[model samples]
Target: MKHEDEMRRRAGAESIAGGDEAEQLDQDTLIHELRTHQLELEMQNEELQRTELELIEARDRFTDLYDFAPVGYATVSDKGLITQANIMLAEMLGVDRNRLIGQRFSHFIMPQDYDAWYLLIVKLFRLNLRQQTELALKCEDGSICYAQLHCLPVCSAQSNAIRITFADISEYRRIEAEKRQYEEQCRSLFENMLDIYYKTDMDGRIEVVSPSCLAQTGYTQAELLGRRVTEFYIDPAQRDQLLSALLRKGKVNDYELILAHKNKAPRIASATCRLLRDEAGKPVAIEGVLRNITARKQVEEQLRLSETRYRALFEQTSDYVLVMEPRTDAAPVIVDANQAAFEKHGYAADDLIGKPITFIDTNISPEAVAERMRLLQSGDPVYFETKHTCSDGSTFWADAVARYVSIGDSNMIYSVERDATRRKQAEEDQARLLRENRALMRQLMQVQEDERRTLARDLHDELGQLLTGIQTRGEYITMHAIDSEVRIMGEEIVRSTSALFDASHASLLRLRPATLDALGLSAALTELTGERQKQADIVCSMRIDGDIDALDDMRAIAIYRLVQEGLTNAFRHGKADCVNVIIRKLPAHAGRDDQLWIEITDNGKGVHAEADRTPTGMGVIGMRERVHALGGTFMLTHVPEDGVRIEAMLPLDHSEDSGR
Candidate 1:
């Protein structure tokens, strides 16, 4: 019971104490503290929101810079995994930005670059330093791009990441390609000289040429570019022939041909053609070189013509032409001889071609032969005569000539022998005949002059005496008769006789024309024209056109006779006519008077067809000879309608002067 009472008392005390503790907490202001704590929490939340907003703005800026940078930027983990990639890097790799993240870096490397990349990664990790490498990256499109990459290794106690940057190398590759191509062109240009060069399009056309081609073909590059090779060749078919040869043997040799150009001048060329081939070994075009052989061809032609002419002259000479070799003694040997030699010496060419000259002449002096051989060797000409023996053992005189000649680039002697036997005989015979002919001509001229003198004496001396007797007798009879009628009759008879004698004297004078000597030729010509005009009852005049000082007496005489004869012809044959005679001094030569011209023209019935139709008529022949003998010209023509013209130009101061 006491224990129970104590426990209860203790319980009552504890309850009072607990109540005091609670009163103390209440007294310490519990609501105020709770409110203060709430206010503090609200303020902290507002400050946290403001800090979050600032962080968001800064993160956005960083993302923009990383994705859009000019060069690619990426973050890789130490395990060769790409943890972050910017937009540029993703594009370079041909992938989405998000897709490239968390990808193994080795997966993006080309197979060719994988080993090199492994080495680079090892260096980056071991040294923990910056590293660079050129890598070919395989993109998602299955294309490769070269890249220069720089990696910054960021290593820490807790993190594994490498910061890497990449640069595209497209422009660098382009420049490198250009440099290599230039070097290749220079090498080809140097090594390919002395050969034909060419370029072709996809078609089998030659599109470019070298300067050597122009020199070879004589055509410009522009001329040949569009033209086929066949067009310029003399033979168009040669192109196909060359093609066939190339297809069979893969090349053609330096073949000879006469080729014609577009202008048609023939050229000789040595040609070598080769195939221009493609990668497939098919021939796409042809390339060739041509060497000009025109000058060589010209030389060959000249040599041929020279050979032909000389051979013909040597073989067919009427003189005994021979080709001889010089001998040490006796005589030079005749290697060849012509037909004339055979006829001259009575030996065939076959007998002489290889024989020494002494074979034809047994008495030829060895000294003479030796001298001739020396002269031939010294390049001098040799000519002499020697007695030659015939096949019949008969001897004849022969003349021989030899000279040094060049044949086929070797000095040689050419020899010729002429048979002077027949020529000498003919010359002797001609001298005898000429002497006889001169004697006969002299006798004939003497006879002709004697006959002319006798006839003139008969006409003047004989007939003049007879006519004088008749005139004196008639006058005597007129005086003796006394009756008027008888005397008148006698006077009539005297007058008649006087008229007859006068007519006879005129006739005798006309036969020789005595007045031709006393009067000058021009004066005589004037008298003749007046008489013709009176006798023919035609109107006529004589006129001289130029100075007559150039006329010699003979030419002057010929002119007079020509006018007189022409007018007589006009009166006799050409009826119903008028006449004109003209004389002039013709153009001169060597400061001397040249020709004296006489032109006698008449308006008459003109020359008959019988007279002029034949070029050689009697009158015309005489006139032409008179002019031609003086080395002058004579021309005769019938004027178209009513007249004839006889023109004679006689050289003055000719031998026909002085009555010769």
Candidate 2:
């Protein structure tokens, strides 16, 4: 303050100066403030420029991510129009990206999924929440797209939209469906298969078994599972064999075993098994299918027993038995033979087997054997009589019965033969004896006829002359004597002589016909037939055609005797009227000799029921012998209503010089 007075005048001058300084200072401060504000403005401009560049880069990255993403992206307006869509979304719809804008999103959705899409969009927009759904989308090409979609509502004050993203799930769905189907098929096969399916651990414990196991093994599935597989085996060693085969070969096919049922009955089974292994190839379990073969096994055993019995019978029988296999290129060959066959053929077993049947058969040819085989194809048994040759070249007859048979898969002919040689020899001996007997009988008959002819000649020549001289002397005495007693005596003597001569003549004719020696057989037959007609009061007709008179005396005598005997039988036994006799000669033809045919037919009573008139009687027997002695055939037919017809055919070439 004191300095204020003294400085008042100085202060005024200082104040002016101070004021100027203050003003200059204030201006400098203001300039500095301006420079700072300008720097801040420049910095703000640089920051804005950098932020714009970053925003542009972010927009480009988002566009690329949205357009090229694996999943499809789309934006839909509240009206369900496709407001925006990415390249992936266009490709998913099989459409161009630019053309996708402003299209109704529901148009691309499958008609079946339209309601679902509508509900999803409504739920998203109304709840302002995210929604998920599966939809089948229709593409521009009209193909379905199985898609899993995720939707988000994009809402603002200006407009409402839904953002959607989807991925193709068709392949995943297909794989899942296939897995379900395969599992179902496996379950059905296990339950319904007829063969038993089983799984067992390495330690022989059953782990899994099918329902069919109960039917085959007579045990329930519950009883089988978790049990030792060897427990059911009748012989435990069989299980060991099965395991060994499975382990060594990794599999076994049709391995047979015997198992015991719960009731202790035997069960025959055939198993096809496989060894199950882990990825590292270590054995883990065994899986198999088992089939019940008990019935089949029983049938096989019965067949075996039957075959054994058949073989025994074949070896022990007395008849020869052979098995032959037929062929197309050659004759049948013997494949097997019984002991009897080898003994009968005089051959060893090795020599006869595999040889052709023709080797032993003397009567068969290869061509004939082939024909027989062809006939056997009809499955009929063939019976035949055949001749067989032995090792010593002797032959024998055999009665053979052959049958076509099938053994296993081979076609065979089985033959049973019996020796018939003795029977054939006996038949031949009998025929020879019959011929000899016939020849001797003919010789005896010829001797008897010769005796009759000699007796007849003696009676006619010697007795006839004596009787005639006596008769003439008696007649002369009667005519010349004068005494009454002498005349009477002469008459009586002449009468007695005449009566004796007539009786002697009648005896000669009865013993042997005089006409037979004088005339031929035809004339003698005529006289005998005429005499029979008069005696029996029957009509007898005769017809003779041949040169029969030229025959030898024996033949002529035979003809005469036959005619006389025939007339006597007709008059006595036949007791009828008309009789016909015919004799004719037939010319030779077709390698036959000239023959004489004789037929005698009579209208008579034929044969009597008493059997005395049978061919065994003396009269019929003599006639048959006479015809047979001359090597002729004789037939006599008797009809009760008609007549009796006798016919004889004699071969002329068969003379007595040739043995009958």
- TM-scores, all candidates, are 0.37, 0.50
In model 1, the clashing pairs are none
Cα lDDT of candidate 2 equals 0.82
lDDT of 1 by residue, 1-660 (tens): 354455446555665677977655553444455556668777888999988988888888888888888778988887878888899999888999888888899898888899998898899999989999899888999988788999998988999788999888756876778888888886676345544355543333667666656555667677767655556668767756766787788777776766775468877776677777889988877666666677877899998999999888877888777676664444667877767777877877677778887898678677766766777776677787767888998987767777978667655567677777787678778966654553454344346434644675687788778767876876777899887788788788778877877676545434434445566665666667776676678988888877663355445545654675677677776774688888887677887666777888888878775563233223555566556545577888887576888988776654433222
What are the per-residue Cα lDDT tens digits for candidate 2 across 480-566? 999989989888888888888777765665567777778877777888888778778999999988788877665666666666667
TM-score of structure candidate 2: 0.50
In model 2, the worst 10-residue window by lDDT is: 609-618
**Total clashing pairs for each candidate:** 0, 0
Regions of candidate 1 where Cα sits further than 4 Å from its true position: 1-250, 253-469, 479-492, 545-553, 590-593, 609-618, 655-660
In order, candidate lDDTs are: 0.71, 0.82
